[model samples]
Target: MVVMKKMMIGFLLVLMALLSGCQMSEVYDTSVNLCIIVANRKNQPDFSDSETLNTSLKNVIDSYGKVQIIVPDGAPYIQGTYSIEEPAKRMSSRKAADWRDIQISSMYNILTTTRAQTPEVDLLSAISLAGRWLDDREGEKQLLIVDNGLSTVGLLDFTKNLIRVDANTIVEYLEEKEAIPSLSGIDVTWVGLGDTADSQQSLTPVNRKNLECIWNSICIAGGADSVTFRGDAPSTGNNSESLPEVTPIDIIAEEPMEVPAKQSRTWWLGEEKCQFLPDSAEFVDIDATKSLLQPIVEAVANEDLILGFCGTTARAPGATEQGCQELSLQRALAVEKLMLEMGMDMRRIGVTLGRGYNHPYYINDRNEDGTLNEQIASANRSVIIFSLDSEVAEKLLKE
Candidate 1:
């Protein structure tokens, strides 16, 4: 009895030790917010196919039991709960060649064949969709991308490979890849399988707008009914280098144009005797009057800007005041034309009206000479330049 007791005690101690070791070695269920980046392989012919690409994506998504897929634009964002068991299995060796190529092909075929959107357009759409995934949540998240090329991480370069692997393995691979350049305006980790996470998050604000325009043009070309197809199409209108020449401020003023800028500052141009009415009474030169506002117009063009044309209204004896109002409107139209000619994108422009002597810039309309100073005359009337509020501009632009 004493010998049996000793043996049982030893067995229990060994079993407990083994169990503790197993517990310590096990990877716990890591609940992490993951940013899944899907980049279109620019080299693939069918890289934009939505159906094919989505199918493959669905397969990858299905393999993970704890993940919830999130599609911001068309679908909700996915929340993933990963378990250690999933990563234990290995992907088939045959399908491991160029995971990026396969992904690109799958996506391209879907969009091209079914959606009828072009590769460039399709790519942009996919990128946009990937970006939208973040709309649902805020704060820190792990960015997992399956694409080609590399991005910087705080001046470091991290390149990675993509194959059939579990999410945890993918995370491990990125950490070991290289020091990466910091992605400005965004905080996320980047991981690539066969290539670096090349979906550049460092795009300049201006470049982003241009990229969107390029995709829009592609949509027009592709005849894709879905806006998604339109968002990513290749730019046909202007290349980055071929951007329209920014007209000088004087030139813009001379042409009577308006422009939009990305920044915000109030620019008010004052001329006292600014002839509120056109020089010709019989025929008001609306366009000609607008020509005088070239400086403001050009400035707006150089900077992402907006324009508000205000004119003082004094009820003259006859149709003079009315004539002046009409002339002001004419000037506004003229400015719009010059803006277009100067290569300022019309999409950035906005128009507003300031009528009458209701709000005058200067207290005294008359100059020291006591005579109506031509400069001081319209000085009471002026145009102000400012930033286009996104919501207001968007509404007007849509209208």
Candidate 2:
């Protein structure tokens, strides 16, 4: 009786596989489904990493598994059905190293694919398409998203007002629109959330925190069982210009463009204003700094408000924390002294504070090989003059 019963159970299982048009091996084998999406654009780091995530991304990027290289423009979809190759099994000693070589080649291809760029980033749609990419695959699903978390062409646009908005509110809006991706049961890892490169402006700590909150909330609400965030600063290989340009997000928080009735306005002495020599507070060109601030001094001469000088210093080689701070303070004071020499009232100048490395206006000032580029460093270490708005210039020009 026991033999008969075993036979009957085996027959039923075979029948089930046959009805599903699957072989017995196919019915039970579950392999991995991994999708890596890189949404970086011009001014954001092209996806470069340590590549230490999982055995050289094995079982993730395997031999003969074709990974699509996509820079999201809009309406992202799986190009067509694809077959994921099975992970390698043992090879004969004659061909022993051949199997290893194939996977290594595949890993290189995967990494290189992400370096491509597009004009627009429809990140939300890409996330949705990734879900579809993983659906028919064999095993436990995993999603690795490498981006700066600033999407340009979707509802989560940073160009408008999403950066300053609350995270939960953004998630709720996504929920209402039914725009959230189906990330249930998938493990998601995000890298380089707030890191910017090239022409993209650097984010303040407050902006970085808000970007983290918004992305985390969205991933969780999509029912992802596990979500991970990584701060792996990307290499400085900026290949974004060759492709169509992506719109940059405004890193500076919103301020009144037109002069307000009662507000102290700030002005950035743009990229080429007064860059300095390494570790020196004195402007590289004292005459240039003088030329830049001359108009401002004359306009605010009659104003009753106090002009505040805020300066920041760079982390040059062998520079200590105290040294960085002191250098930044001196930089600010140097600007103030120059203004005074130009007939500015000392009484109008307010307390000068050196922000030091606390706030970097431009970030990722390193070479592709991860060494500090002093030229980039010199450019970021500078000062901003603020007391009255550019409206002061408008008023003076009209008078």
Candidate 3:
């Protein structure tokens, strides 16, 4: 009798363990709101291909699991592919002085919808939809598979356009429609658009086939998800062009001349370390520093004079002038050492100290003290500029 009782108890415990395991698995296998945007039109000659693609998607989705077809029907979590035209538009100003090849056509019609859905429809919607699968601890990330390439204009230009949209148009639309912003509070896991995948065609629309392949794979292999997508540029032709012998311009420094014309002093990191740096508290990573130092090293080899500016900040709430100076010095020395390692002639390169508390160029408070922070740290920060006389500096500054 005692043996029977022990066995019963053990069986109950085993059942409970199985139930708990099932619960844990259910938590990880989340219901994803997949949104796939394809560029196509039903009335066009390409309609046949669209039908085939749709059927393929249906088969794939059915084979995987329950995927709700996201149409206009009030589903918050949408997974539908739509079409857009070729030759993407330039939302911002003209690129070249001539304005010959700049594309100004809006592929997706923005007039039918009340607000600008391109930001949401193209990229933000997918990101937000994917981000909704947060666990109990509030950690849900999504991968953005943008079918279209990002606008290839400069970063500042993109930021400026975003600001303009926010201030003038998008904000008003949000307020009038009483719609909570779709993309206000989501983190991007990986932003894979159609631009980066192509070797020659870095700015092309992502094809429907490849996008479907990636999405199907993701659904099949479920887990803690990270965003990863490759940009696919448009394929122009199969034939490879022969390379032409050309002179490479030295952008990092200026060559010494017997008679100096008006010189302009500007600073740039070598191709690799062009990313933004938030604060000096973070130690400069060796690889990041090295990336910025490559151009300087190359320019110095051509016997060009280079200058590096070192400056500190007292902008952070607890920061002091002394501390800022020390940090600035470290940054300067970091760049200096990198140039030395790259076989640069240290004699041709000069390092100057410009540590200060006042920033005249910026209008923001880094400390979040709720004060109008109008300090320009860019002027005081370490930079490499060409050597020039006071008259030339003033002229360049005005220009």
Candidate 4:
């Protein structure tokens, strides 16, 4: 009897040890707040890939602790719980399966309803909204953006080649518009970029690469932890394949334009009075402006020179400081896009800084009678292009 009792005690001790080891090997579930932004529009072909998108959505919803679906330009948008509740006990297989089914049904309904309601694709607004939604949330945060990465409205207008503009330029624009969101600790995944089949223009390899770089830069600048680009069909599993690597851009040197060997030169591209329409960034004469920029473009193409554009705006009556700054940045970007079209290297161009009512060409715009002078204010609304030699360019770049 004593031997039998000893054996039973030994057996119980071994069983407890094995159970503790099994418990240690088990991974604790860490909650994640996931936000998914879907861009629904006719112009974006990626939206048509419903099967892949739905599968990816289902997989993510099933895996994450909490999920939110947001469509900035559509109805029934921004639906999902902000916080996830932890249960006292682990969910059973049946309960988990039911929960997933309910979530999938809810996601499908919300997405379909939103798509039917709105066809506009406002990617910037949707992303900003997602960032705002994720702010202050606990646990791991992830943002999945399913779109062609095109913004037709708001500060970023892809139709205008805004993506070609430098990242710093876009950051400044966002700051001025108060559209910058706190996205620290967020892992951002951008899927379905440049899949614009129904659009008037088709995307080339170079165009696609530029678009990806722009978004990557934008997300990083906005304090995102990381940015990944997954093409039209992202894999739903852990070993999912990544998008094809973007090739380096080849810069072809063009014939140099005749200009004096100067350290720096500033060219003002504007009308006779340097006048622009009230709160407008559209150039009056694109052809003439390009003609004037030909020399600078040639210089940048042929030499290792850097181009810097400064946009200055005059404060109009009742114009907010932020509004003026945003207008100036847009005007600068307009010129930057022209330069890009003219075959200048995107990396060679510096950030377009917006100086709103700060650096005025016509400082004496105030009339003797203390009335605001429209002519001088108009002069202030000019895009000044500065061409710098190698030394000057390096110095300014360091600064």
Best candidate, lDDT: 2
Tell how far residue 201 is off in model 2, in angstroms. 0.5
Residue 376: error of model 1 in Å? 3.3
Could you give candidate 4's per-residue lDDT for residues 1-399 as a string of tens digits?
999999999999987765543311124355567787863445444343455555555545544566777865433257555333433354555565566567667666665444423544456777877888788677668888777676665567665657566767877887788777667899997767876533335566666777787778778878999988765553232211221111122223335569766456566765452335567877677787778778888877776556787677766667777887788878888888888998889988766777666553535556777677887865666777776554433433343
Give the local distance difference test score of model 4: 0.64
Report the C-alpha lDDT of model 3 over 38-142, residue by residue, as the tens digit. 322111011112333233333223222222222111122353332212214322222321121221111123211212112212233332344343221122222
TM-scores of the candidates in the order shown: 0.27, 0.51, 0.27, 0.47
Candidate 1, residues 1-399, lDDT tens digits: the string is: 999999999999987765543311223243333344442332212223334334334343333212222221112223232321332333433333344245436434532323211222122233334444443434323333333222211111221211112434433443465322222222332222122112323333333343334333333333322322112223222122311121111101123356644555554544331333343222234455456556655676676556543333333334355675665455444445555675666765566553444333334545465556554455555444445664433332332
Question: For this target, which candidate reaches the highest TM-score against the unseen true structure?
Answer: 2
What are the lDDT figures for the candidates, one per model?
0.36, 0.67, 0.35, 0.64
Cα deviation at 56, candidate 1, in Å, is: 22
Off by over 4 Å in 3: 1-265, 268-283, 359-399
Q: Mark the 10 consecutive residues where model 3 has the least summed lDDT.
A: 40-49
Candidate 2, residues 1-399, lDDT tens digits: the string is: 999999999999987755554211222235556676764356677555534333325544443343433345543434333344643453343343455456556555655554434466677888877876666555677777777777887787788858889999999999999999888888888877788877778888889999988988888898887888876657757765565566778777645468646455676664378766766775678788888889888866856667777776666656676777788778778888988999998898766777666563545566887677877776667677776344532332231
Measured on C-alpha atoms, candidate 1 has an lDDT of: 0.36
